[model samples]
Target: MNGSEVQFWSFVTAALLMIIGIYAIIFMDNIIKKIIGVMLIGDGVNLVLITEGFKPGGIVPIISEKLYNQSPGIFQEFADQASYSLPFALVLTNIVIGASTLAVLLGITIKLYQHYNSLSVHEIFKEEKI
Candidate 1:
């Protein structure tokens, strides 16, 4: 398909992921499931950001010798042809942060499970109320 169609599908997929994540976070009782939902939401957001920066027939924002040898005004052409790199960089940063956050969250969940002997949010809350 074309670039626009690809972008549309990417956005649709991201939206679906986010929706499913939200549903899981709200409806699921298990801590691990909720963590998975949070990870899904983060992934959906990253996907959307990455897709937003995508361009059809776009090249990296770097000058190459081949491009320079092709034309005298290669710099201008390169600038025009290059896709936005910021979103990709941001996504990378987000991925790292998300992974760390997930690790920390899982650690906390493990600790909670050790103390409570259960992973269910309902059970934990019910115990806390007593």
Candidate 2:
């Protein structure tokens, strides 16, 4: 496939994942479904971060005097452009945070299921006093 076509598919895949997550959150009554939906949304967000980090025909941003000397103009041009590493790093951090949050939330869900003996989120909340 052509490069653009490939990129388009990549975006579409991410989008579809996000849509599925949203649907899961909206229609599913089980607490697990909500957690899965949140995870799917996180995946879609990570995909967006990856797409942003892509620089077409661009090399990794490794700065060094020797490399710069070899291609002085090229190095300057590359430096002038934005680097992908920062966004990539941020995305990685966010992924870790999302995972941690999901784990905590899932633990709470499990405890809730143990106490309630049902997977229905509405029932769990309904049993609450306020």
Candidate 3:
């Protein structure tokens, strides 16, 4: 497939992931499943960011002084071919943040499980007092 086709499919996949995540969050009774749903949504967002940064047959965004000196006109060409760095950078930062957030969420889940002896949201919150 061509670049556009691939990008379009990637977007479709990302949307599917997010939708499934939402479904799990709303319909699943298990707290762990809900947490996994949130993780799925984050992964979908990451996929989209990566897709947005992708360029067909792209090169790394790097330029050497010697290479630039050899060809003054190559800068524009390089710029055109170089996939965006911002999206990738954002995805990286998001991954780190997401991991930390997931850790905290799981930690909370463990405490809730211990207190209630159940992973079900309804069971944990049925009292609605804690």
Residue pairs clashing in model 3 are none
The lDDT per prediction is 0.93, 0.83, 0.95
Q: What digit string (tens of lDDT, one per residue) describes model 2 on residues 1-130?
A: 7656666777888899899999999999999998999899889888877777766555677778887789878766877664577768988899899989998998999898899999897888786785
Worst 10 residues of 3 by lDDT: 121-130
Model 1 ranges off by over 4 Å: 64-70
Compare the candidates by TM-score and give the number of the best one.
3
Model 3 Cα lDDT, one tens digit per residue, 1-130 = 9999999999999999999999999999999999999999999999999999999889999899999999999999998899888999999999999999999999999998888899999988887864
Q: State TM-scores per candidate.
A: 0.91, 0.82, 0.94
Task: Put the candidates in lDDT order, highest first.
Answer: 3, 1, 2
What are the C-alpha RMSDs, in order, of all predicted structures?
2.0, 2.5, 1.4
The deviation in Å at residue 24 for candidate 1 is 0.8
- Model 3, residue 62: distance off in Å is 1.0
lDDT of 2 at 64: 81
Give lDDT tens digits, candidate 1, residues 1-130. Answer: 9999999999999999999999999999999999999999999999999899999889988777886888869888778989999999999999999999999999999999999999999987884643
